[model samples]
Target chain A: MNVIVEAGANYVGVIGAGEGATGEQMVQARRVGELLARKGVRVVTGGLGGVMRAACEGAVGAGGVTLGLLPGSDRADGNQFLTVSVPTGLGEMRNALVVRSSEAIIAVGGSWGTLSEIALAVRTGVPVIALGGWPLPGVEVLVAQSPEEAVEAAVRTLAR
Target chain B: MNVIVEAGANYVGVIGAGEGATGEQMVQARRVGELLARKGVRVVTGGLGGVMRAACEGAVGAGGVTLGLLPGSDRADGNQFLTVSVPTGLGEMRNALVVRSSEAIIAVGGSWGTLSEIALAVRTGVPVIALGGWPLPGVEVLVAQSPEEAVEAAVRTLAR
Candidate 1:
């Protein structure tokens, strides 16, 4: 069997709670996605709700491509802001795909799932700029106390 | 080009925040990993820190085969709990590998990254059981109001 490895970067994945849409966390997520969008970056997410919705909303509001990586094969469930939806049918395993599709990850305030994505990022050595959580191990671990700082760190890191 | 799809429950991908040394979310994540472990599930993650670490701890505690998918090509950065580590030099894209290799996903509670994973799950048509978050649309959104419920939903969904 022959295996082919192909890589492409069209999006930056954002991980966070689907809840708490009206808090500082939500504000931070939107700002990050917006900054990336204003720079012509496409924002990708799990697509259906919460932070995904906020980021997508921000990216689309800024005239950027908002791609939603959905978990199932159905398209009806996707958030309205998604420009494109890639259905993986892998359930939570699809989290891997979200992180894989991005050149880097910007984690906002998150719970356990965000932690896993960061773990995935750290394990993979992807430059994850954490905005509001405990710092990741070893990598740049840009402890940005503000959204602007997080976006700045990501821009700098991706530039490298 | 022909695409060959592999079948069967070869591994169980566990998604967590990596901060779950102690907490309800961590407890729930551990419970889910343990359940899968008891069922002979081969667990996989980013292979370092937080919920990833906790899940590995749970799986190992239950005597399951744990695979840590690292972002870098180096083995030194991998989690100490992993029995096997797959190092992908693709950096954060390693998240895609973790998702692609698994048959299912269980989101314990999340933040930005977890939301992205959930979006991926919804887009991909993967059956994701959210332990904590808003209700997902289209797919079977098993809102596990508790840890046991989350684990049960994840297992039941995977069985289907």
Candidate 2:
């Protein structure tokens, strides 16, 4: 068990819709954040509204650190739950960084932006566990039934 | 015509693929850059390769100022044609800024990244001229057969 314990910093990105998240999506995303936080995993996100904020809040609630990669130039654009705010004024182009930076990803229902992240992640060989997220062709992403399952898959993927 | 060319900074975004652009794509993008430069329009781009580099080179060839919004943190990642390179470190999300900052957009052949920019620009009501680029759904973007026509459309849109 001691041998399996990783030594370096591990970042888990929780990706989903920035705005207009459904009630169920927000709940599941927040729960995923909480579960990952409880296991001492650092949660990463785009840090705006909807699912990003929910995940960050969940991480914060569980005493876990959250990193917010904001699209705007202003740091204030980040959510209140972020422990660190990287205001990357790159707008939507920052999605590549978000997908690339994460060791593993937990994706809930998302938009075209989220679809793009999934594509980028798959292309770069980043493991993604989708919880009702966009379905892409020619990409092999694991589908989770619930938040608990998503977090479980994430942990298993990263532990290896 | 001289009166119409008022003294102001006209920022035009030249967006397209990083690589895999056809020779025709490069030629048209270059001509667009040249035309914009002749009309005193400041060209903006992602500043790496393909259509962006070609556009910037044309702008420089015609003595026009070009700005590159780089995705990486390294200033050296940007191409040489840019008069000013803004290292955004935001990766692909910089597309939004590239679109929003420009008064009008000229899109050459592109992949997923360029497709995202076109979608974003249309969402924000920024005029776009697609010079043999992808055809997006529900977006009213102008399709031009040549670089001259693309530049003409952009100039007309911005002037209005």
Q: Which prediction has the highest DockQ against the true structure?
A: 2
DockQ comparisons of all candidates to the true complex = 0.10, 0.17
For model 2, how big is the CA root-mean-square deviation? Answer: 5.3
Expressed as tens digits, the lDDT of each residue in B32-124 for candidate 1 is: 777778877777787877778778888889887788988789988888878889877756556656666566677766644454555454445
True contacts kept of 1: 0.11
lDDT digits (tens) for residues A1-160 of candidate 1: 4212114334678878776654777777888878888877788898878888888888888877888888788988898998889877766666667777777788887555666676566555577878776433344456788877877777776643
What are the runs in model 1 whose C-alpha is more than 4 Å off?
A1-10, A134-140, B1-160
- lDDT, each prediction: 0.70, 0.83
Worst 10 residues of 1 chain A by lDDT: A1-10
- Candidate 1: lDDT over CA atoms? 0.70
**Model 2: per-residue Cα lDDT over B1-160, one tens digit each:** 5543456779999988778889888888888899999988999999998999999999999988899999898999898898899998866667767886899999997566676676567656788888886444443779888888889899998864
Question: Which of the numbered candidates is closest to the native, going by highest TM-score?
Answer: 2
By summed lDDT, the worst window of 10 consecutive residues in model 2 chain B runs over: B132-141
For residue A151, give model 2's deviation from the true position in Å: 4.3
